[model samples]
Target chain A: MKTHTLSSHIISYVLLFCIGLFLVTFSIYYYFTRSTIQETTKENAVALANNTVNRIELVLNTEERIPEIVAKMLESSFLDRDSLIPFLKSILKNNKNICGSSISYEPNYFPDKGMFYAPYVFRQGSKIRSTMLGNENYEYAFMDWYQIPKMTQTPYWSEPYFDEGGGNMLMTTYSVPFYTYKKRERTFSGVVTIDISLEWLTKIMSTVKIFKTGYAFLISQNGTIITHPNKDYVMNQSIFTIAKENNQPGMRDIGRQMIKGGGNFASADFKSKWHPGKLWINYKGLPSSHWSIGVIYPESEMFASLHQINIILICLIVVGLFLLSLFTVKIIRKLTSPLKHFADSARLIAAGDFNVQLPEIKTQDEMKELYNSFSYMQKELAEYIVSLKDTTAAKEKIESELRIASEIQMAMIPHIFPPFPDLPQVDVFAVLKSAKEVGGDLYDFFVIDGNKFCFAIGDVSGKGVPASLFMAVTRTLVRSISDKEISPSVIVSTLNKSLSSNNESSMFVTFFLGVLDLATGELRYSNAGHNPPVVIRGNGDVIMFEKTKYIPVGLFEDFDYGELSLQLAPGDKIFLYTDGVSEAENVENKLFGEDNLMKVIGENVKASPRDLIHNMEVGLAEHVKGHTQSDDITMMTIVYNG
Target chain B: MNVLVTSSNDYTIVTIEGRIDATSSNEFEKSVMEVIEEGNTKIILDCSGLNYISSSGLRVFLIALKKMKAIKGQLKLCNLQPVIQGIFDVSGFATIFSIFPDQKSAMER
Candidate 1:
């Protein structure tokens, strides 16, 4: 059997199991039902037959009184051979099925000479003749009843036998001896005997009859079936004989008797005279002649069991019918799942979007076939969609390239830094994190010659790539020109003259520049409209280094940039920043003002350049927490270790 | 502190020379924009010549770039030195302008 999915297989298996259970239950019921009916019917037949046989035996027992009567008659009056005939004739009159009754006594017939029934009257059909009475050849001494009286020297009875001379069946005889003795010296007087008819047995059985299909049968303890309703079937016939007639060896076996309570039963399907398919049943050894009686009907008519079996079988068949219906419905749904997908595809095709594809279902069934067809349609539709996406794809690609270029611009500045690492004499740090693609803040530093450290800071007025370009050009010019040995004021004055000539945009830088002599405590510095830097002394006083502000560089030509010098101690620091730091905002849009910057410096008044820059950033953030910054932020701190 | 600047379309290119700190920052801003009145907004600073920069120098660059913005022209850089190039990489300013390997290459762009 092929395996099925869980739910459906469980249903089918449970149904089959239930059907099997019902069938077994019905079979058991059928067996017991048929067996009960068969046993009861056999028992009734045997009991009824035995009753009839016993009734006839009573009449035969009454006939038994004749011998006692004869014995009394012989004892009361002395009976010579002549008187024996009248006595026997009187006893033989009334009963019809008996043909004759007679008695015999003689020394020649007795096995022992001391036994006697002499002067005895033995009658047969109303006469006692000489040869029948006194003349005994004694060769008949070998006869069965004669030895009983001769050996016991008393009375004897023999079963009925046919007397062919009279052509009568079952004429039984009883005999008795007349005896006299003084002290154990008994004299031999011979025996008295009487005969009886056996036709009375048949007469009683004939009145109680059974139906045609039914048979009332009897068996002897010695395996004989006698008085089997059919008179011709009377003697020596038994179940064995019937089994031999049927040629079946199974009949020879004694069938197992089923005993439950009072019920003792046996049945044979080998009942037929010629075949065993028909059932024969019996109850045997009925108290009398080792006999049993039974009523045997044709096995075909034996429906006591089959009737109940049919009912249970019907219930099983009905269950099987329902199970088949459920099975078909479940299997059909599995077969049609792919059709649902096809319908979904048709809807998608109508909507003019055909990119969806069917999922894989790997079965060599009808559903898989439908999926294959849908897969083909999906491939064609997907190709059509792909062909139409050219313009959209190119636009996305350019956008991505522009994004990369914008990131490169912002990154070109020192977005994070300790701007001068090796010059411990001048601790410096700067940051130029952008708010857009670019911003105009710029800062630079390097050892121009030995301990002569040069640095500058400036800011552009606008934002984005354009402003960044200007910042780049201006930054490069400053870095290049600062290399020439000159005072800070002269270098800037030269640059101012250079820019003022073509300053059509009227844009200018508010800037500060410085050159440090590391061996001495002096910083040559200049300012061009830039914020005054915070200066921290070696002791602890913080002061603003504000030179008289000049016009921003690049505004006009021929403007002088004044320079000043401040004596620095070994631990002096200067903090420089663009407005991006002082004007920083949080998400609340609150500005981080100059007061906060001063406060931050006051708090970390003796920090190193890096720590000063970091502490100022912290203060700005604390002043304007949770607000987004509005401009590019750049700040730097430098310490002098002169 | 890295720099790369170039000149094109009638502008003479001038690149910054070194790290601009509190000491040299004001001078650095003055040197770069000195050519602005000479009609050179179409200038590219070869930031490759600049060794370092700080926030003060950033403020000067802001001031000069705005001047060019008002003048209605362009400035670009060519060839950035690596350390300053990393700053540009971090700040996302590489997207803000055109950059090239040299003066002639930037002028061609």
Candidate 2:
């Protein structure tokens, strides 16, 4: 029985639908945006790495070309060892990128000089200085820059090293072995070399940046880190050693790939030793120096903006959903407000105010149809109530008239307890009770010729107004025509003849008339279609009048009736009643039959007429036992005294 | 009250059953009147199933008799229960109406 508003139901469904749609749209947007941002990040990192590597390659190529030009001069014998010093000085002075140059010969190749003789010229800040780079204490012939080119008899670039005695800085040398024509064939001479300071490369790598905590680094072909943001790692560690320290097998793989002159521009397969978390790296190898340059992009910093955009998008969707719910509730409530008014009006109508005004609905919808139905029902109820009121009033009027008619009919009979108060020779009492507002039973008595007493009792065949009227007419006919000389049978026969003449309704009445001889205690009675009256003797013996050759009154004209006579003793009582007494029903539908009536009359044989009728009334009441009276009852008793 | 009517070449038989008091007299009257209105000259009211009759029911029988007499038709009754026969005897209806003990005896009339 608990109820919720339609508005709440609609709002819940709407919010659910909106949430589903938002989740689908947001998920799709998130997927494409995340992939697009990742792609752009990769492309941006690669471009930055490519730019940095190209610049480093361009500078290294120039340095390599300068050394090749000097080696060719030495090979053609165009410049002797005397011109080589000035030549190196001029080359160092012209190219600011070159920090130092040295030309080393075999230990005793000149034969005139002692064991070690190598000419070196370098720029010491703003001065052009020349000195011997190798002596008894320092062996330049055994160095990588000198020995590798001489043994390989080809040009080579050495791994970067710190030159403590000569340049006093981190530097890499490109050495080219010279050739001498001996017996018209090429013979290996000492090496011609130039050194470039790695300080500038280190400075450039330190300046390279991708984002916060993102950096660039360079590793030489031997897998030794040359220039890096962390200066300590540059000279002291290789890529493999850093990978080992960090326990990153992926870094080792990248290192192996890089030293083989292989790299990728979009692989995020490395982590910086100096930083924690995943990093995207774009690494490229320099063609001239065979050094790998890597640009590190810490993933968190690289996608920080993308994460911020996603947070903002989610917040906007949440706000949008909330606003949608609020507006939907408001709109739904506005649409359904008429139902509330209808409910109020319906309650008033149910409480008997059929004329209560209903809210008007203009829209052609279900609510409008309901309004029409309510109006129609109200009109119908009002009309029905009005007609019911009229019907009830008419019925009440008819009932009141019947009650008055019953009173009039009761007045027509002699209700005075002692009919012959002055004549101690006779006693008579009677009673009549109707089952409805009017009764069909009648009892009457009068003194005829001042010595003869005439008594009559009759029952109309039906009940209600028609039967009551018939009984009244029969009683009137008996009273008007009976006289001292008329016999009981003749009086009844004449009444029947008069009643049946024009009786179109076919109603009839049962009649009994008696003339009592007060002086002789003789009773003469006629029965016409009526229950025979009982006569109780002074000896308490009960007897009934025998059957007569007559039908009830108003049945047929010219029907002859017969009479019976009985002599009563001084204390004898003659009890007369309609069938209402003998046929009175009990709750069990058993009638108070003639036997019980005759028994009661015999028991009260010595009682007065009034006492006899009272005893019979009490016995009948006891027999009925509160059962509804189904017929009118009349009883009359005549006690003759002689 | 239930009234069943059957027509034969000689007469129409009206079988009335159950108690016919003030309430059921109208239905009894209606059934007999319908039979009389159908121009049936002879009607045999079978009282075999009639166990009780009130004054109002007696009035309906009287009306049916009067209606039949006015039309010059015959209305006979048969198979009256003893109690009902006593009522008829007291009311002197046994003298005015032709009564028979069974349907076969009434059909011979």
Please give, for residues A43-160, the per-residue lDDT of candidate 2 as tens digits. 8777887888877777888888887887788778888767778888999989987888888876877778777768888878789799876787888888888888888787888998
Which digits, one per residue and each the tens of the lDDT, describe model 1 over residues A1-642?
Answer: 426644466667777786788779768877787778666666666666557656755675576566666666655545555666666555555545445544555444345534433333233455543234333444344566666677777666554456666554645566666553435665544455666555665555456554335555544344554455665556545556656776756665532221110112345645555323566554433332223445455555555346656767787678876876587657756665556667777788768767655655778876677677777777776676676576568867766765675566555555545555666666677767666656767776667777787778776655555557667766777776877855899878877776667766555666678888888867898877666778877777888765344655766576677899988888888888876776576665455766788878888877766787788777876876756554667787778875
Q: What are the chain A TM-scores of the candidates, in order?
A: 0.41, 0.68
> lDDT values of the candidates?
0.62, 0.84
Tens-digit lDDT string for candidate 2 (B1-109): 8999998767899998998999999989898899999999899999999988987888888888888898998989999999899899988888888899988888898
> Number of the top candidate by lDDT?
2
Give per-residue CA lDDT, model 1, range B1-109, as digits (tens).
Answer: 3333444467667777766653576566667756777777587676766765544555565556666777887777777776555434432244444567787787886
Candidate 2 — what's its lDDT?
0.84
lDDT of 1 at A339: 60
Residue pairs that clash (backbone atoms under 3 angstroms), model 2: none
Which window of 10 residues has the lowest lDDT sum in candidate 1 chain A? A255-264
Model 2 bad stretches (over 4 Å): A1-5, A65-82, A86-95, A102-121, A141-194, A198-215, A218-303, A322-326, A348-367, A395-501, A508-554, A557-642, B1-6, B13-31, B45-58, B77-105
Stretches of model 1 off by over 4 angstroms after superposition: A1-14, A31-53, A72-84, A108-142, A152-160, A167-195, A203-642, B1-109
TM-score (2 decimals) of chain A in model 2? 0.68
